[model samples]
Target chain A: MSGIFNSSIGRKFAMALSALFLMFFLLQHFAINILSVFSPDAFNEASHFMGTFWAVQYILQPILIFGVIFHFVMGFILELKNNKARQISYAKNNGSANSSWMSRNMIWSGLAILAFMVLHFIDFWIPEMNTKYVLGDMSGMHNGEFRYFHELVEKFHSPIRVGAYVIAFVFLALHLLHGFSSAFQSIGANNKYTKSLQGFAKIYAIGIPLGFIFIALYHHLTGH
Target chain B: MNLTLKIWRQKNASDKGKMVDYQISDVSPDMSFLEMLDVLNDQIITKGEEPVAFDHDCREGICGMCSLYINGEAHGPDRGVTTCQLHMRKFKDGDTIYIEPFRAKAFPVIKDLVVDRSAFDRIQHAGGFISVNTSGNTQDANAIPIAKEAADTAMDAATCIGCGACVATCKNSSAMLFVGAKVSQYALLPQGQVEATDRVLNMVKQMDEEGFGNCTNTGACEVECPKGISLENIARMNSEYLKASLKG
Candidate 1:
């Protein structure tokens, strides 16, 4: 495993696997969040269901947390190794004029996304989980349902909190645009299939985050 | 046609470089870009000032040595030719052109528009060769039948003049195109298979060690390349590097 980490191919494979895992997690998270647009009552009920589920809280959440941590740590470590390798004879001319901005800024963008994730978990996930699990307070009623529906709506009412969510979603989109296609290429998926994958990844990269942002904006604008 | 030139001037690598203005009146519109520079140099010598120094071994478009960053574009405004082949007719009279040497952390200006490109040569020396020996009575050259498509691609990859245009146009100063060409040239040929893994790994290692930036696949190098080298070579190199990494 150490040898694989040291090798160029090993690092790429690690990146691909981690990226795919993260993408799956993103889809799951997006699906749950999208429910807010249809009905806050339904969303809170769904959130309550998820918050109370023993399997998700005990088994899947830990695995998801591990995946996120592993992906972040490995991405940084690989980038550092590549940077160290390129530091020799630093006076050579950079003759490549045709690379992209996003490709070069991956590390910085990744750091931004990582910081956003920490804030995100603390802002919502912790409170949602804690109120349901620890305090056992699932208050408020809307449309004949006893759920934390009011709390969910009340949180987005704050302009500062909504702005933070919007900003973090932007960073997430930027990360996904580059990360999606890069992951596929790293895994030797460079063919006709690769083009469609890149296109789909690009759409998802924009669509999912925008979907989350719209929900926050819609709630804030409607005075919910 | 007359044009004003703002060319970079420096005594040597140790001296500070700056842009110096020069005016040439009544220049012919048909003169090639280098020929216009030559006319300016002659006037500079008549005024007892040192002539501008730039690299241009082949007047034709083949030798990759004629590197010029003209008006913020590599090899001037033209799409698929070197500075030596760029015609003055592309510019109108009374135009102000800013000419500078290709600037990168790895490529230091030696004098005027000339930069020390020995770094590229050094990276090549790291492992840009096959390990075959030239013993007498070797196997027939035609013994191995390579596909026509592969042969054509190899020829295209072999066209890289090592001119550093890719670096000049790249936002990250990545040498992925040049390095890719070198790696693909060998990876496509059976003669290069015996030591393919070592060759790619060493070359990539040397490339990174030289302080060039990472490839972002922006396709700018392809646009600026005098020979019009494709980014497919880069994709090929990435694949080769990945495969080689797995073997170890």
Candidate 2:
């Protein structure tokens, strides 16, 4: 509701919900991308299905884009408001005495992830959109073969691209390290199960990003 | 103990504050942090200079009147104690202590080391009480058969003394912990159930209106709270607010 979006807690709840969506999307994206390392045919078939599927293209894609945009815009707004809350800076502050570095620097890490997202869209989504929508090429074919896996491999062939991805994934790790548990806390999910949940959050945060890094490194090192 | 004090001094609410350094000697280890400040004030009085102005009343740690950001830690580097209860033994001889007021737009500096915490008062005034029809029909406190665990949790939340340490220590200057405690103190009780929805909605509205930041769950507030108010109160408030908004 409009009222929900109007309040501070409501905005945070929305932010946490969007973060959860994006994190889920990241997991699936990693799952699909990692397929290129293990089985290129499977990766191509999966990517082709996702690209051409009517339900995914029409329904989920728009929602995913909205979620991403909402997360970023809301994050910037909250950061600005939070900055205004403390008009006078502390003469001395020992933030690390009680909180972690990742927790304190979420905005910086979030911005890093945003920068990588721009590059990622440029390298993949924009071209895919141009090919599928602009050129009206629904076939998902090039050179009489499935182009998804080949395009992914071709993109990673650039050392610069691979290096950029590696750095982005590192920032992704840092962002998720604080963000995963933080989202749950924002939603008031803190309870006895919170300890185990935080443990799981840590694994998912570190593991998923590391998986993406490995996939990128595998493709870059394999020279394929 | 001989010590160097770098204390923030401002003439009034409108004055630009600056850190003025002073050297004091023969500070007894047994003296509380406030007592040591009293010693420094005596010295300033003897020299016909304006003494530092800070907030303190009970000096026994329960009043929550005293607030100081000492050496970058709220209540001067001690855990579970206010500035009034912080002992001089926590510091070494020849230590240079930096003291400043709790910095937040909602909590502006009123004078040297004193901030106007009336923002907390405003938030409290919003919904920090349960409605009682006091027409010579006061009910017995025990008439409401409250569960012991809930009562204990409510008591823990009630232990919060409206200290600004949480706001001072929070990176975002979020007052969520303070507002959470106030909300939870009522939300966890049968007597408080009637107005629970309005309490959370109004208090949170006032808190945001007062320019407190949104909580990031960094949890510095819980660590620095003199009463050791848990972060669970915040979670409770979030859930309460969510339920209230959805119900409406």
Q: RMSD in angstroms, all models? A: 4.7, 1.2
TM-score of each: 0.81, 0.98
Task: Name model 2 segments beyond 4 Å from true.
Answer: none
Clashing residue pairs in candidate 2 (N, C-alpha, C atoms within 3 angstroms) = none
In angstroms, give how far residue B235 of model 2 lies from its true place.
Answer: 1.0
Top-TM-score candidate index = 2
lDDT of 2 by residue, B1-248 (tens): 99999999999999988999999999999999999999999999999999999999999999899999999989989899999999999999999999999999999998999999999999999999988888899998899899999999999999999989999999889999999999999999999999998899999999989999989989899999999999999999999999999886
Q: After best superposition, candidate 1 residue B132: deviation in angstroms? A: 3.0
Q: What is the lDDT of residue B74 in candidate 2?
A: 90
How far does residue A188 in candidate 1 sit from its true spot (Å)? 5.1
TM-score of 1: 0.81
Error (Å) of candidate 1 at residue A173 is: 3.9
Weakest lDDT window of 10 consecutive positions for candidate 1 chain A: A85-94
Candidate 2 lDDT over A83-140, as tens digits, reads 9989888778888888988889999999999999999999999999999999999998
Q: What share of the true interface contacts does each candidate keep?
A: 0.13, 0.76
Interface RMSD of 1: 6.1
In terms of lDDT, the best-performing candidate is 2
lDDT of 1 by residue, A1-224 (tens): 22544445446667777789889878887787778778776777777677667797788888888888888898787666545433322222233333455665678878888887887788778876677668776553446765565666777898998898898888888888888887776665566577788889899999998998998898889876
